[model samples]
Target: MPSAISRFAKFAAIAALTSATVFASLDDAEARRAGSSGFGSRGTRTFQAPPVTSTAPAPAAPIERSMTPRPQTTAPATAQQPFGAQRPGLFGGFGRSMIGGLIAGGLLGMLLGHGFGGGFGFLGMLLQIALIGGAVMLAMRYFANRRQPSYGAGGQGGSFSRSNSMSPANNSSFQIPAIGSGAGSRASSRGNRPSDEIGLAQADLDQFEELLTDVQTAYGAEDYATLRRLTTPEAMSYLAEELGENATNGVRNRVSDVKLLQGDIAEAWREDGQEYATLAMRYSSIDAMVERDSGRVVSGDDRRPSESIEVWTFVRKSGADWKLAAIQGSEQRAA
Candidate 1:
């Protein structure tokens, strides 16, 4: 058999090599991630998928990553906490009295040298007490979790009246001087269309178009400041992570000729004083990745522009300009 010390050294070596390999794999994965992958916060609708639009006939991809905290669902309210909430205080009432009696009996046996606590002494008594207390706590916790209600298909926030949400008071419209606004282009009947509580105007749509160009160019140029200004903090963080990965891979993304072909509102809603709009857009651009130092194209055609269809969710609070909050790729090709 190999000596114990030699075996330990070999094990350590193997562990170190494995750790290095894992880290290298992670770095490569990050590099390939490029940018957001159907990720980012969309307020209460973070987990919900946006509706498909004419520009993007297919459904939007599910959000794979997000900063939005998952909403905590609770059981229906009753007289107490929830479904028969009778949480006893981990060995409370008569249980406490029984524990006290046991401790007293154990101490008495120890005084008589009758092998109290398995003949281990006071330390053993302490261990016994700890073990019992831990068990009681665990049992209480398990019951509590069992009683906790699981989220339904849509949760509380998911089910809302489309007619009520898209009422005249909440109707948002815009007029695009260039290609005509897509207002009233929505499906005649609202099935799962997200509703906006607050209405947005023509100027907001115009600005959204402007932001589309600005954000794309800024990301291509790796301009962190511009990106920060145009996107929400959470969205900016994801963009920065992508940029860092590109830098690590010694390459950079370049984009130009950003022209919006068509776009339509997928959903618009307001919550907690913030306005949100998810828009499906089709645009063309010359997007390429190139070596950082030499600026030689590595992935995309520099001259030939390609089309992309994506859903972008924008958010704004009070009187602030709309900022990009999320990005999702379309799921299916347009028929």
Candidate 2:
């Protein structure tokens, strides 16, 4: 009886230990999810910029969000007329000529007798009038065709104008270079030129790095005010929600040692008088979660650092400070 009781007690102890291990593992996984990068949402999930090489992989599916603003189209300027009015229409210039032709034809027919010959006089007068009227109509049509504007070969007539607006001359030839071929040279040339096209400078890149650190630090501290100022309203909402969930679970996410490893501009553009830039960044940090009351680690390695790659987009109005607009995970990370 004693031996049987001993075995039963040992079995119960083993089962209990196994169960505790499993639950702890689950808790750690959940904690990692709570503090993971790419937790917040912003902008459309679909990739909109031109493709570029990056350490991060492409997203398996497009994100769900509204698309960013696009450039505003300006209406074409109206061409000024020499006399400050529209040119005369076809009948406006030929009305008198047409009237004269009709009068002359009638007079000629009346002058001829009603039966000059054998009842053929009236028919001959009618024929002369018809021929005169047809000649006048043909002349009018010819002049109208001449006055019409002519479009050059290969020109489409809809919304696009035939004349090149960017060039000083009326016509210009623009060639787009193939991607990955002479791209560096083209980029250098564009950098040299003065245009409205968006391009990131060294200072702008530095600011991006700074923002990455600032955002993570502020998030770890649960600083809502700073987060609101640094991120867009949409992103702010998401971060707040995640932080709330952590609080409800009685855990606090802690992040530190945030370091940017590598980064490059995925794309940049100006739209609706605002500038936007998306950057692919590989960074490392120490992320962990601890119990609020006991300060016991619930998940993650507090001593070791982890590396993650993410794509972040920033937006700003002209002459304004840039703010975080969106964040996406690299191929291997889950949002």
C-alpha RMSD for every candidate: 14.6, 32.6
Alpha-carbon deviation at 246 in model 2, angstroms: 0.8
lDDT of candidate 2 over 15-110, digit per residue (tens): 433433343243234324332234233334233322332333343112223344433436555745533223654444366345564444444335
The models' CA-based lDDT, in order, is 0.61, 0.52
Tens-digit per-residue lDDT, 100-211, candidate 1: 4564555455445443346674456547645654664465455544533321111111111000111012122232322222333353254554344455567777787888
How many residue pairs of model 2 clash at the backbone?
1
Pairs that clash in candidate 2: 45-63
- Of the candidates shown, which would achieve the greatest TM-score relative to the real structure? 1
Model 2 TM: 0.48
The TM-scores, one per candidate, come to 0.58, 0.48
